[model samples]
Target: MRVVLDAMGGDNAPQVPVRGAVQAAKELGVEVILTGKRELIEDELSKYSYSGNLIKVVDAPESISMDEQPSKALKKKNSSVHVGMSLIKNKEADAFVSAGNTGAVMAISVFSLGRLKGVERPAISTVLPNLKGHTFLLDVGANVDCKPHHLLQFAVMGEAYAKYVLGDENPRIGLLNIGEEETKGNELTKEAYKLLKKASEKGLNFVGNAEGRDIYSGDFDVIVCDGFVGNVALKLSESLAKILAKILKEEIENHFISRLGAITLKPAIKSFKKRIDYAEWGGAPLLGVKAPVIISHGSSNAKAIKNAIKVACQFAESNLNSYIEKNIEKYG
Candidate 1:
C-alpha cells in the first residue's frame, strides 16, 4: 500500500521524515511518498542507503509551521500538509502521516476528507502504555467542547479502535471523571454516564467512570473524555514520565551506592523506558476520519516516523471507518 508523509512538518524537518520514510519503505514494505520541497527532501534522502524506487517525493514548496494558526494555514494550497491531504482525498495514497501542527492537520483533514458517515465529530485516539498493556484515550485536544452524544461516539470509536488496531477482544470503556460514581462529574459527565450505561446494555462493554488515578492503573482499556480534560491528562502523563526519568538519572549519579544499584537494575529501567516512550507508538490515530491519518509528535525522531508509518499501514488494512459507522448507527 502507499502512504504519504508530510516531510517538512516536524521539528527535524526533511531529515527525520526522509530517514523514517526510507526505513519504513525498507522494513515495512510500503511505498512512501514524501511531500515537501523536492531539493531539500532529495538532499536528506541521498544521505541514506534505501530502496530508491520504493520512496517517491512530491514537491510542495510551502510548509505550515507549528505556530501558524490552523485556520489560516488551511488556505495555503501548496503547503506540504495540504498536498499530503489531497493525495489521500484523491485516493492516491492509503494513508497520511505527519508530526506537524496538530490543529492544522485536524482542520485540514475534516475540511478535505470529511468525517465518517454517522460520526458527529472526529476525535483523536491516543494510546498510552498502561501497567496491564495499554489504554486508549480520546478526544485528546480535538473538540474542546462536546455534547453528551459526542462523548458516547468517542466511547464507541475508542472501543472499535482497541479491537482492530490494538487487538483487544473486549475492551472496557470508561468515562474520565472526577469520581467513579454515576453522580460524580459536571453536567457533561453526569449526562454522559447515563448514556454510556444505556450503551453498555446494548453492545458496549462500558465499565463505569474512570478517575485520573485509574488511567495508568490499567483497569480500563479505553477512556473517553472531552478534548479539554483529555489533553490535560495526556500532557501531565508525558511530562511526569520525563521528569521521573530525569530524577532517577540524577539520583543515580548523586550517590555511589545508588549508581551500583542502578547497574543492577539497568535491564528493568531500560524496559520501563521503552514501555512509556512515545516513539514506540509513533503517533495518535485521528479516529472517525474517512481514512487513516497519524499525527505524530512534533519532536519525533526517525524511529517515531517509521513506527507512525507502520500504524498508518495497520489502519489502512482495518475496516475502522466502516466498523465505527455501523456501531454508531446501532446507537443512533
Candidate 2:
C-alpha cells in the first residue's frame, strides 16, 4: 500500500516527517510518498540510512499555514495538503496522513475524497488512553454545532472505528453528558440519547449516558458527543496530563533523597509517560470518508509519524468503509 505524507505541514516539517517516512517504509514494509519541496525532503533523507527502497518524494511548492482558513487555503492548488489529497483522489496513494491544521485536513478530505455512502457529515474520531484501555471519542473539534442526527451519525461512525481499530467485536458506547440519568443534559444530548437508545435495540451496544468523570474509568468503549464538548474534554485531558507530569518532575527533583528515588523509579515513570503520551497513539482518523485520512499532532516527531503511517495502512487493509456502508441502516 502507498501512504502519502505531508512533509511540510507540521512543526518539524521536512526533517521529522522525512525520518518517519523512511522508518515506516523499512519497518512496515509499505511505500511512502512524501509531499513537500523536493530539495528540502532530499536533504533530510540524506541524514538517514534507509534499508528499504519504498520511500519516494513528490514536490509541492506551496504550503498552507496553520493560521490559514481551510476554505480559502483549499483554493491554492499547489499547496502541500492539496497535492497530497490529489494523490488520493487519483488513486496514486492508498491513504493520506498530515500533521497540519486539523480544519484544513477535514475540509480537504471531504472535498477531495468525498464522504462515504449513508454518511451525512464526516467527523474526527480520536483514541483516548485510559486505565483499562482506550476510549474512542468522536466529533472532537470537527463540527462544533451539530444537530441531533449528526451526533447519532457520530456514534455510528465511532462504533465502527472502535470495533475495527481496537479489535472489539461489540464495543459499548456512551453519550457524554452532565449526569448518568437519561434526562440530565442539554437539548442536544437529550435528543442524542434517544437516538442512541433506539440504535441499541438494533444491534449497537449503547451503555447510556457517560459523564466527564467516568471517561477515564473506562465506563464505555466509545463516547459520543458534539464537537464542542468533545473538544473541551480532549483538550482538558491533554493539558492535565502535561501538568501532572511537570508537577511530578518538580517534586522528584526538590530534594537529594527524592532525586535518588526518582532515579530508581525512572523506568516506572517512563512507563507512565508512555501510557498518557498522545504521540504513542499516533493520529486521529477522519471517519465516514470514502478514503483513509489521518491527522497527527502538529508537533509530532519521527516516531509519531511512523505510527500514523502504520495506522493508515491498517485502516486501508481493513476495508472499514464497506463495513460502515453495510451497517449504516442499523444505526439509523
TM-score of each: 0.97, 0.97
Instruction: Compose the digit string of candidate 2's lDDT tens values, residues 1-332.
Output: 99999998788888889988988988888899999899999999988888567998898998788878999887878878889889889989999899888898889889888899988889998988889888999889988998888888888888888877778678888889999999999999999888888888888788899889877888788888888888999999889888988998898788779888777787987898788777777899999888999999999988999999998988888878888887676687
**After TM-score superposition, what is the CA distance of residue 115 in candidate 1 from its true location, in Å?**
0.8
Can you give the lDDT of residue 332 in candidate 1? 51
* Model 2 CA lDDT for position 310: 91
**Cα lDDT, all candidates:** 0.91, 0.87
Please give, for residues 26-81, the per-residue lDDT of candidate 1 as tens digits: 88888999999999999998888774588999999987889899989999999998
**Deviation in Å, model 2, residue 263 alpha carbon:** 1.3
Global Cα lDDT for candidate 1: 0.91
Against the true structure, candidate 2 has what lDDT? 0.87
Cα-based RMSD of the predictions, in order?
A: 1.2, 1.3
Q: How does residue 48 of candidate 1 score in lDDT?
A: 85
> Clashes in candidate 1: how many?
0
Q: Which ranges of candidate 2 are over 4 A from the true structure?
A: none
